[model samples]
Target: MSSTATPTVEIDPQTVVRKVTRNVIPFVFVLYIVNYIDRANIGYASLQMNKELGLTSQAFGLAAGLFFIGYFLFEVPSNIALAKFGARRWIARILLTWGALATAMGFVHNDFQLITVH
Candidate 1:
């Protein structure tokens, strides 16, 4: 009598890459592009918003500059924590915070309010 285990299926690496490229890369690229557009839309709006809000160019510039400050301060640690934890939960937290701050900027009545809250 001959006894042999049945062979398992094998997946090809090129097939996997092709699948990822076809299925995943477009969504990822679109998401990144949208995220950037959402963030920068504020700056584009600020051009008109500053005049309406009575914010000086310097104040608007400061507010815009602070976005990077927050990003810089939190980015590395947030990425590290995400690596230690997981992408889903970590990204959710980051996006939540980002969205909240972004929304709050719309509500600022003055530069002082903007500077203080942000």
Candidate 2:
């Protein structure tokens, strides 16, 4: 039997960094944009929604408070999934979930319902 030798190739760190930045930064930027837009719109939406849903200010305030609770609960599991599955696949999974959730938005009726959905 004949033994074959493998050659090692050295990659430039700057090129590697550029490539990673190109791939990773845009997605991170998008995540930030989506985050801020959601925050702003939720504030605007809650104002209108409180009037339409007949939510007491206290109830609306409670709903806003719970938003962070839900965010904290989901953030860790989602980040774990992102690390396990890779960004492209994890992002697609998130989009699919949010698409289904967006459809469910039509069915909410009252403060409790809206609070649970949010």
Candidate 3:
């Protein structure tokens, strides 16, 4: 009978954890700040956007409501996609898609377009 030996690898868990957190947290924090700014910018924009688009308070309110509704509807599916596709690829795709849509939002001239883009 022949005996085979397996080699054992040693890793420092604390060091690995510290390195990952140090590298990842800053990027994630920046993303959170950007997302917060994007959401809050709508309130700021409404001051000018309402008058320019001729959108009434009710219409604007509906659009705002729809935004949250859409977010709620997609949150689960997005999480599922993230799990399936992995975070790095999924995050890049989401950021690109969001950037394109946000840019498109700036070009909208009417309530329908605003609602659709937002």
Q: Which candidate is the best by TM-score?
A: 3
lDDT tens readout by residue for model 2, 1-118: 9999999999999999998899877766766665565566558877677788998999988877887898889999999999999998888677656545545555778988878876
TM-score of candidate 1 to 2 decimals:
0.65
Please identify which of the two predictions, 1 or 2, would achieve the higher lDDT against the true structure: 2
Ranked by TM-score, the better of candidates 1 and 2 is: 2
Q: Which regions of candidate 1 are displaced past 4 Å? A: 1-34, 116-118
lDDT values for all models? 0.75, 0.77, 0.85
Worst 10 contiguous positions by lDDT, candidate 3: 25-34
Tens digits of per-residue lDDT for model 3 on 34-116? 57766887899999999999999998998889989999999999999999998767877777777677778789899999899
What is the lDDT for 4 in model 1? 100
Best model per lDDT: 3
Cα deviation at 91, candidate 1, in Å, is: 1.2
Q: How would the candidate models be sorted by lDDT, starting from the highest?
A: 3, 2, 1
Off by over 4 Å in 2: 1-9, 95-107
